[model samples]
Target: MNARHDHSHQREFNLEDREFRFLVSFLSRETGIVLSEHKRQMVCGRLVKRLRSLGMRDFAAYCALLDSPAAGAEVEHLVNAITTNITNFFREPHHFDHLRHQVLEPRLSQSPKKPRIRIWSAGCSSGQEPYSIAMVMAEVLKPSEAWDALILATDIDTNMLKRGADGIYSAEDAAHIPENYRKRFVRRLHNDSDHVQMADELRRLIRFKRLNLHEKWPMKGKFDAIFCRNVAIYFDKPTQRALFNRYADMLHVGGMLYLGHAESLIGMNDRFEASDKTVYRRIR
Candidate 1:
């Protein structure tokens, strides 16, 4: 290639490296999503659109802007922009099915304690996971003064939590939801769009918050079940092990931990015994 072509290529490569390193560092610090060297292009491509939208001249300047005093709000936007929040109502049905048929039903039949169920969606993005749990509980557990249930939906990304709290979604977002749930829990928009909002009852049942798994959790009591699916794949082995140990500590004896299909606690900790594929139970 000519000298000018070589210089242009070098500039592009340097910019790509800067963007990749900045994103990897930022994501790891904020949410613990470890991006490997191979993911550099993916990170660059994803953020390039955002950079263009913001009218940034280069990745270096973008990183500098992110370091400013106004960076807190910008950081929230950055995290939301880059993190993959691809989720839908009941995206993984088996976990909820197990919660309903195995955990809740048995507890109701056997326990003498008042019927109270607490579930934490540890990495709930835009609220679908926890809201789905709420929907199941609402259907199975009668709405009464006697029964108590709550779903704590938490994520490190505050922007996603805001969207989740808003409880509005495009019509296509609600497409995969079953007809019964669709009718019972969602109100369709009349603007000829597929947008829908979660019903007041279901929205009330879920409490959304911003939580980082690496930080000290403010939750006081052990939960009956914790849904932290598809969140640990980014952490290294040690982090994963520590996280699972914490999950075990935070769960009631015999409480279940559901992981994503691509994730597992295998060889990480002994406190949880594998109950099934993508599911672990607190044994001790």
Candidate 2:
């Protein structure tokens, strides 16, 4: 009886081809994320909980809700469900190392004016990437008051943005942080040893906001570096080309752009010249 009930529930939630295609089209148009035929299962799996939460029995009903005028609010929820957020403190350590040595350190030693450093973590999942960047910035910019340094952490996921602004994480996740940074920038909770929070100092160095890359960006000033890692992979070739061109415009000449290990600008855009592994310097 239990097995039969579970099977029935599963059958009720099956996504039909029409509904899957609608989802693929809606997602691409709304968020610039392309969902191909192979991603159908992944889409279904990820959105099941959203369906269940809305008391939906099938994908057809969910699709109808998305198409209706009432979808304005639900749209946010749908995009959040479809988007993936996976990151860690110093997930790609090499990028951080490059940021320190090639970007920050040289500016500190050679630049005559008060150093002004700006970095954007374009798809910063939660808060880890920017926080890792903040740690390095704070370390290099001695007597922090002397330098104007800031990290802008942006994501389309409001939930992720909130989590990043809160700056709290599981204690075990702290293991990923370098020992020196851990000691200096991580704070133990008053009574909860199971969790930790980013130090106020590091938190002060960052600004978190919800931004869809497909939309117009609000920032006016150019950045010294942009870490858009792992994000362009979700976009199609045309979208990736446009986005890279936009990044080039947002960066200063000789500023750096960091891509995910799987992402490259080889033939995508020539505005940037390769600087290091998965790192490119804006030349024009």
Listed per model in order, the count of residue pairs whose N, CA or C atoms clash below 3 Å is: 2, 0
For candidate 2, write residues 1-284 as lDDT tens digits: 99999999989888889999999899888889998899888899989999989998999999999999978888889888888998899988999999999999999988767778899999998989999999999988877888888999999999999999999999988889999999999999999999999999899999999999999999999999999999999999999999999999999999999999999999999899999999999999
Q: lDDT scores for all predictions?
A: 0.82, 0.93
Candidate 1 residue 144 Cα shift, in angstroms, is 4.4
Candidate 1 Cα deviation (angstroms), residue 126: 1.6
Which candidate wins on TM-score? 2
TM-score of 2: 0.97
> What are the models' TM-scores?
0.87, 0.97
Give me the runs in candidate 1 sitting further than 4 Å from their true place. 1-14, 49-55, 66-70, 111-113, 190-193
**Model 2 error, position 215 (Å):** 1.0
TM-score attained by model 1: 0.87
